[model samples]
Target: MNKRGKVVRDTNAGTGLISIDGQQFPFELEGMWKSDVAPCVNMVVEVDFGADGRVASVQVVPESQLAREQAEAAMRATKDKGAALGKEMVARFGAGTLAGMAALVCGWFVFNTITVQIAAGYSSGLSFWKVLGVLNSPLGFMNALGGAGGGSGAYGLFAVLALCGPLLPFFVRNPLAHLANLLPLLFIAAVCAIGYFGLMDGLKQAQGAALAFGGRQAAAMAAEMASGMMKEALRAVSFGLGAYLSVLASLYFAGRGAIKYLSSRA
Candidate 1:
């Protein structure tokens, strides 16, 4: 007798069973077949039954053919879905690929401009106009790269570094289109570091002065001032991070939308 079904094994019960068209039959898996194929649950196989009605031999189906079929099916489904999405986007956005690209560029420019202004103003305590001016100047972004007190030579070095930054993305392939992408984050970090150190220095000075006065009340006052400074620094850091993330989110959506529109035209 011959039967074709899926193999199932109950490890806890130490028994093997074959299920065929909703019918299950107890079977003893042959040991010789185990050398060529390991018995696994849910694997389809052909079984040869002895005259006593017990399984005498089993031939497990090769999984490679099934795997290949499944992979091809998945690829077809993905292609179909992509085609449908492309058509829908074209119908909605029209076939203006150049317009979509232009929109993306404009959106990125606006976002970058806003991010620079916020980061520079927060870090340097400069007005929006001054930050904008600095960003527009060829040497401007270099000045904002690090903290103050650098000599002319140091400034020149930073300028070179800044100029070389954008070229980095061309050399590297994985993620991060340009080093400029990290400018906003670096600016925020620099600002926070400055603020934190300044606060710590002030607190230390205040504590030293209070200790000189020689009273528990003075110590209490020093502690209070330190706490207040920490809270203010935290608030500033939070606000800067929030603003940066918001700008990044806007840029991401604009870029993604533009790409989608352009792809629809293809």
Candidate 2:
């Protein structure tokens, strides 16, 4: 029989003891040693036993080979565990989560929700993720913080919350996941609110300047012109197909969560 274990005593040129499954066996270097890897104390080896129950031959296990085997074993265990966990999540959450995830991913990849028009005559569209990127940038960050650093940080905060929507579904059993999915709608509303207020502020400023310098006639004309321009701007920035899909995904999650929560309560 061949057994694998480590050497408890070094036998570089003479006899020493090795442990194989709690049994120590005596080995000699003259004939028993059979590998290029030097037999040192604590080195793992395969021990071939003789009919007399003594160590017949000992071959050292290479460190590289041992490490490779250990790594492969760990990888296999992780793969199996991950597969089991995925199956469990699928079973627990059913297709609701999968569908929601698919829709949410599609929404993230589709048409942008915000449009930026430059005086240079070109315009750009931005999705929620891109908006988050802009918010995180130095220039955008400074602009978001405003002149006195007193601007509402709620936009970035809500955006961060909205980004977490997809991750919440992984909880499998948490009812709070419904709230996470709904964050997208809130974020969308927030963006729209910001745009609306910005347009209104611009309208107010134009009217105020016209009234102060150009009299009632100018103020009335400015108000009329600004109102039309505001409507055009709103059309330019109206919610894209992506926003609609994201809303649908949020609604799905909400409906699923409500049913699940009620069922659990009953």
Candidate 3:
């Protein structure tokens, strides 16, 4: 009769390992049992093999153990995927990608602020240094997030999305072009969501700022400014979304029109 226990050690080298139950045996020549064996620091396994002079097949069993092994396998698979994605991001973006993204965001913020300053009756005479100071305000958070460089988990997601972004063309020709045309709408939606959340945060911050300043007049003025800014941000985001959708719809229809025109010519 066969007996089973966890493998305490592989005392027999390649031939077979000794189970904790003191059963000495030779595993199958095909090594089917070896593939099923998982070596952890102290993983428990239920082994089954008949002892005989001839080589015998050993199976690690316990019907319930199947689920445990599968769960371990799943964990390994996820770990491997995350590692592969991290490696890919390092290859594509290099170590300096974070710094580059920070610079890009800072530059965008500065340009937009300068545009706003000119529109708000501020003399176009603010020195470059003054503009730089304004840019520094938003840079704090943006730099932190961009510097984090999308951790291993987020990099895994980015890698998957990036791979899919390129592959879309195989099923739909000119997918890159199509995606570029569509991205404005996506960007707008993202901005709208960001604006909505930003409004909530700003409102909370405004209440805090009001309490900090004290005096009903000061609080009312701060609240009014916050509300005005929120409304403007929301309006801009909504208008941007509508315009982006309009452009995307026109571009999509135009592409269809071109295809139809060419098919008729052919």
Candidate 4:
């Protein structure tokens, strides 16, 4: 039987008890309740009965509609918040300035590196390690131009450069904490670059010796390659400080714009 009822006892059931024609039936609520609005006690509801006359489907009527409206209102509020955030972002970065800069930097690296790798008969695929290598050292830039390097080095280099970028300003403002920030990137790159180069050099030497025993010139070639790799590692350590400085400059400019906008608005 199809009937309409009002919820009597809530009692924490998936469906609540309802009074229908002066009779109480255990009824289950269908679907989900909306956040911020819920079915009220004694709210009118519709129910379908099973063969045994038990409630098959129970739905709160007017209260459910109220819940739906509340949910939509909440969604609208969230959209407004998102719009405000967008406006704040635009004010801080000057509406595409940061985006354009990012595109330029990434594009320059990709275009240069991809072209060289393609010409060298390497597959036209990007390598994270290679990118890191470039970031860590001048050798990393060289790798993009057909030198040997990887992502670990590139990440290290970027880190080092970023750390050094804000040193002078920070030192002038707060010597102790600012100074601590300045050379961390370089130090990190140094440790990583040293470890990587050392491990690779040892491996190459071992391979070269094995090949030379078979009358190949592998050992001599590997030894020569090791010197160049070692040189790149050293260069990476030296240039880390410069890269850190550039990153700090970028962040400082971005932050300055944000502060100016906020002060003006205030």
Candidate 5:
């Protein structure tokens, strides 16, 4: 005989009880179904009786109550896993590690941006080496506070923006989790800007200068300028690529650490 009922474990006796309607029947839960359906309290279950009248098997009836119980169990398991991972991270890396790493990454990103911009500026003939030296220094970051009036001023502002990009995410804890997703696109934009403005523009200017000179001297000077521009463009490309890759790598690692920290905190 098979009857639908709710499972009730007798804690003192360490046995199973089935409550059906107003009556209670004692039964021995059998099969792997016993453990599988163990935690679903008050859930409707099918109790099968053997010919000898002992309980043969127990199975949970699929219903809204059972679904809700399963969902709750899954949520609990997920929370437990998250807590365990958080504890492990704290034990291994400590609590403040993520914040420290983020600061280091931000500093590196700012430094890399400054260096790349300086190299590109030199290639474009927009600034001399001495100016590039000052701009590449730590004090150059102060330029970010200044206004954008001239070309170099605009470049300085760009440098400041680049410095802020990785660091700003750290200030807004919620968005730091998504920095990895944004780094690839940011790297691509940096490469394209470096290629067009730093390399292609310089080549165009050299072509224009060649056109203005006239005769064999003009041809020789234009060739020399074009060659120089090409060399500088290659150098700028290398610097841009290096800076972007380094920043992207830093962001990737820092983003992961931030995610772990946030998940554990939550």
Candidate 6:
């Protein structure tokens, strides 16, 4: 029987190796080639095995056959990957493709959905993936979240943790890994608090600057206007569905982790 392989190299005048099914087999270019010249590197060839299961002869396969074989190989590879992925999912979830389902849900509601709609704010309506990218840049976060700069960007750090820290538990061993259950909740809390405080801090600075320029005489009016300013500020920032959905995801992670942990203990 004959097999197909790509020529790996023409090492010398009459000797070389070819890769077949990912294994390299040496072939003699002497009388076995059947061609005037030995096959060039990267050329596909048909191989005949000897009684000892060694390479007997090799010749270039037809172009049509090469193309058909390549397509078939690609299809086989894709099927193999899909089968492997399905098996892994079943091993982990004990059922269907739970991971794929979660990813699809998250991709729609969390990754692609609008995070917030900011009428004038920088952080408005951007997808979750972009928000994650900008969270690392202090000025970027401030600009995106408020269209203003100067916040310590502590929320951005928490946001990073909220987005990425959950994966740690899956990779680490138990006990410590168990923290994944509660960590998401903590991260979400910390991010909310820090984000709110950062905004308030910026607002206060603006108010103080107003008082500084207006002098003590304007303090009365500043105090009078403070309540309205706070109201307007709160009204300007409306949370979008994606933001809420993201929190729900984090909550789900925590709840599921807790269930698994408790079940293990039981």
Task: Give RMSD to native, each candidate.
Answer: 18.5, 6.5, 16.7, 13.1, 17.6, 7.7
Candidate 5 has a TM-score of: 0.31
lDDT order, best first, reads 2, 6, 5, 4, 1, 3
TM-score (C-alpha) between model 2 and the true structure: 0.60
Candidate 6 Cα errors over 4 Å, as ranges: 1-65, 93-124, 129-138, 141-176, 220-236, 262-266
lDDT score of residue 38 within candidate 2: 69
- Assess each prediction's global lDDT (C-alpha) against the native: 0.53, 0.71, 0.44, 0.53, 0.54, 0.64
Model 1 ranges off by over 4 Å: 1-164, 171-184, 226-266
Position 115, candidate 1: lDDT: 28
TM-score of model 6 (CA atoms): 0.54
**lDDT of candidate 3 at residue 180, scale 0 to 100:** 31
Worst 10 residues of 1 by lDDT: 108-117
Worst 10 residues of 5 by lDDT: 123-132
The residue-by-residue lDDT of candidate 3 on 182-252, one tens digit each, is 33234334434654675588687777778787867877888888888867744432122223333344344
Q: Which residue pairs in candidate 6 have backbone atoms (N, alpha carbon, C) closer than 3 angstroms, thus clashing?
A: 116-125, 122-144, 123-144
TM-scores of the models, in the given order?
0.28, 0.60, 0.27, 0.31, 0.31, 0.54
* Clash-forming residue pairs, model 5: none
- The TM-score that candidate 3 achieves is 0.27
Write model 4 residue lDDT over 126-237, tens digit each, in one string.
Answer: 2323445654554455554454555554455654464344333323443233333334334435545865776676767676675768445766666667668667644433
The order of the candidates by TM-score, greatest first, is 2, 6, 5, 4, 1, 3
Model 3 segments more than 4 A misplaced? 1-137, 140-184, 212-218, 228-266
Error of 6 at 80 (Å): 1.6
Error of 5 at 183 (Å): 5.7
Find the candidate with the highest TM-score and give its number.
2
